[model samples]
Target: MHTDARVLNNQSLIEGDICIIGAGAAGISIALDWMNTSKKVILLEGGGFEYDDKVQDLYKGKTTGQKYFPLKASRLHYFGGTTGHWAGMCSPFDEVDFRKREWVPGSGWPISKKDLDPYYAKANETLKLGPYNYEFDYWRKELKDLNPFPLDDKVIRNKMWQYSQAHFGDLYKEAIVEAKNIHLYTYANVVDILAGEGVQHISSVIVKNHEGKTHTVKAKHFILACGAIQNARMLLASNSQAPRGLGNDHDLVGRYFMEHLEIASSELWLFRPFPTNLYSWEYGVTRASAELAITEEIQEKERILNGTASLLPLSVGKHQKPRMETWQDEDPRKSSESLFKNWSEADEAAKSEKGAIERAFQLNTRIEQAPNPNSRVTLMAEKDELGVPRVNLHWELTALDKRSVRRIHQLIGQQFGIAGLGRVKLMDFLRDEDDDTFPDSTNGGWHHMGTTRMSDDPGKGVVNADCRVHGISNLFVAGSACYTTSAAPNPTLTLVALSLRLSDHIKRII
Candidate 1:
């Protein structure tokens, strides 16, 4: 049953077996997994089914160090979370992504890809993805003309990707509202987590809204399914008892913030027109596509981060501006319009270019940023309408991150020369060998990760292997906040799968 928290009386006490905060992809996926179960699950969403400007203001704050998108526009505040405006690209992390690399300072996860394999298949159902298999051969048999380039398979490999436009708000709204066991609460923004005696366990939480309504939620188990930014902000803001922040005895709650570095790398000028649908996407129509990715062995040998290179037609792509420059409007709606308008103009201008070469394509990179402690989220003194402190972001990138991107493209150029099929011209920013700075055009994938990272030792992380907050027995975080390191692909798929794994663990313990 669906209930708006605004309608609930002040001081209303909501009791449930499991209280899941922030009804985004992770929260909804976990709630759906509990369908028909005897447990009473409470799913809380700060905004209603649609976008609300007031609720969005809570996400607004300041950004420092690296240039970034407007805090308010970076993520959606509605029921669907950022997926409401997401491009819906999906791919699994390589096995090496979960392993410790000597070159990457703070890389490696407590769990491995093997642990998430079953959950990944189960997550595909929730994400509306194709078969669990991401093998190029499997997709080649299923899709038409999915042929790879003539690169050495031993060094470089195709990173297959699937697409899904499943906005949870639009797709699962009715199901969540109709479910008998799940209680869906809208306009319920959790402000502070109230802990009992020793702060070892979360007793209940305090939620408030702009309507001057304050409520309490009591549950046997609490799962914070909010995004990485909000999840850390919430923890840091709830400093009444745990002065250092709950589960933050080591001062590591909001550290190691990571994003996938997405930027224009080089130009791939093929000797001849490469005719294959393998490395292309048709927006909403294409079921699956592939991007050129460096093999695990190559990454280990080269001592670089895992990344993929995607091809965009040089005709239109050459004129395309960086995403950081185009998506500047504070209002997400306006920002999207501006971005689409820019893309449309680029495509339109491409049609009029007489000398546009069909054989050339821009090689854009989607790579993982090296985890740096300085890249973090902190709490600001300014309070939102609900009296919760706003967030302050410091997105610091390291020299390793810069070196990795340049090396990845250099490797690509070397491989292209070996294949004798094309030549790669490095971008202007990468032309200078000693330049250690990224221009304002540097674009990130808008993936927030590692704020509440997981580790078996509390000194190193906020959460444990099972997603439970280290010091708090009944408190858990169920999203990218627990990610130890960011991978090349988008986080939505792995986050959903991780949430499912957490859901199963909660069933056994809670």
Candidate 2:
């Protein structure tokens, strides 16, 4: 059954077996996993079905260090969450992302990729994606006439990406509302997480709405599946009972924030027309496509982070603007409109060379930033109308992050030249070997990750391998926020898979 918390009586006492906070991809995925189960699942969404500027304002905050999207417009607060407008790119994290790399500080996950293989298959169904296979060979067999570049496998490889069209709100709204076990509360925003004795277990949560109504939700277990920034804000803001906030005794609740740096890195000028559909993709029509990437062997040799380079027509790419600049509107709707308009215009400009890929291609680099503890989300002094602390994002990049991007392209360029594909012209910002600073136009992937990172050691991370809070017994986190290291592909697929794994663990206990 679905209920609007705003309509519930003030100080209402809602009860459930499990309370899953935030109705985004992660939260909704976990809730869906419990549809026919015996346990009563309480799913809380801060906003209703549609976007409201009032609720959006609750996400408003400041950004420092690196340039970023407006916090208010960066994510959607409605029932669907940010998936309402997410680009459907989906790929699993590389195995190296789980291993500890000595060169990258704060790297490695407590859980290995092998632990998530089964969960990833289940998540593929939830996301409405094709086979769980991410290998280019698998896709090449399934599709027709898709020949790959003859690059040495030891150095560079083609990374495959599958698209997911499943928007949670639209795809699962009916099932969620009709489910007898699910108690979805829209307009219910969690403001505080109360703890039991010793601050070792979650007692209940305090939720408030814009209508001045406050309610208490009591559950045996509490899972925070909100976005990374919001998840960190809630943990940092609920510090009344626990002076340093629950699960943050080690002063590591909101640190090591990371994002995929998506920037125009270089131009791959191929020799003559290399007629192949390997690197091109039409968003809605294509099921899967491949991008240039470095192998783990090469990454280990060069000590660089994993990243992928997608091809764009030179005409459209050179004319395109950085997403940071185009997505500046404080309202997500306006910001989305501006962004799509720019993409549509670029598509129109690139139509001139549709039949002929004959010459130059722009390589847009999407790489993970080294986990910098200094880059983090902290509690803002100003509170929202709901009396919850807003988020302050300090997005900082490391020297390793910069060098990794340059090195990735340089490796790809070398491989291309060796194969006599063509020479690669590095962009101005990448040419300077001594300069560590990025241009003002450098764009971020809008993928928020790693605030409440996972680890086995309490001193190093907030959550354990099972995603439970280090010290808190019944409190857990399910989302990209638990990521110990961000990988090359987008976080949506891996986060959903991780949520499923957490759901299975919760099932065993309950």
Instruction: TM-score each candidate.
Output: 0.99, 0.98
Q: Residues 381-467, candidate 2: write the lDDT tens digits.
A: 889999987888999997898999999999999999998878898999988898888887888877999999999999999999999
Backbone clashes in model 1, listed as residue pairs: none
**Following a full C-alpha superposition, what root-mean-square deviation does model 1 have from the true structure?**
0.9
Candidate 2 at 227: error in angstroms?
0.6
Report the C-alpha displacement of residue 92, candidate 1, in angstroms. 0.5
**Could you give me the TM-score of model 1 versus the true structure?**
0.99
Q: List the residue pairs that clash in candidate 2.
A: none
Q: For model 1, where is the 10-residue window of minimal lDDT?
A: 350-359
Candidate 1: where are CA atoms >4 Å away?
Answer: 354-356
Q: Which stretches of candidate 2 lie over 4 Å from their true place?
A: 352-358
lDDT of 1 by residue, 1-510 (tens): 999999998999999999999988999999999999999999989999999999999899999999999999999998978889898899998899989899888777899999999999999989999989999999989988876888898888999999998998899999999999999999999999989999989999998888999999999999998899999998998889999889889999899999998999899988887785888897789999999899999898988889999998888897788999999999999989998999999999988975539888899999988888899999888988888888889999877777778888888888889999889999998888788788889998879999999888888889999999997899999999999888899999999999999999999986
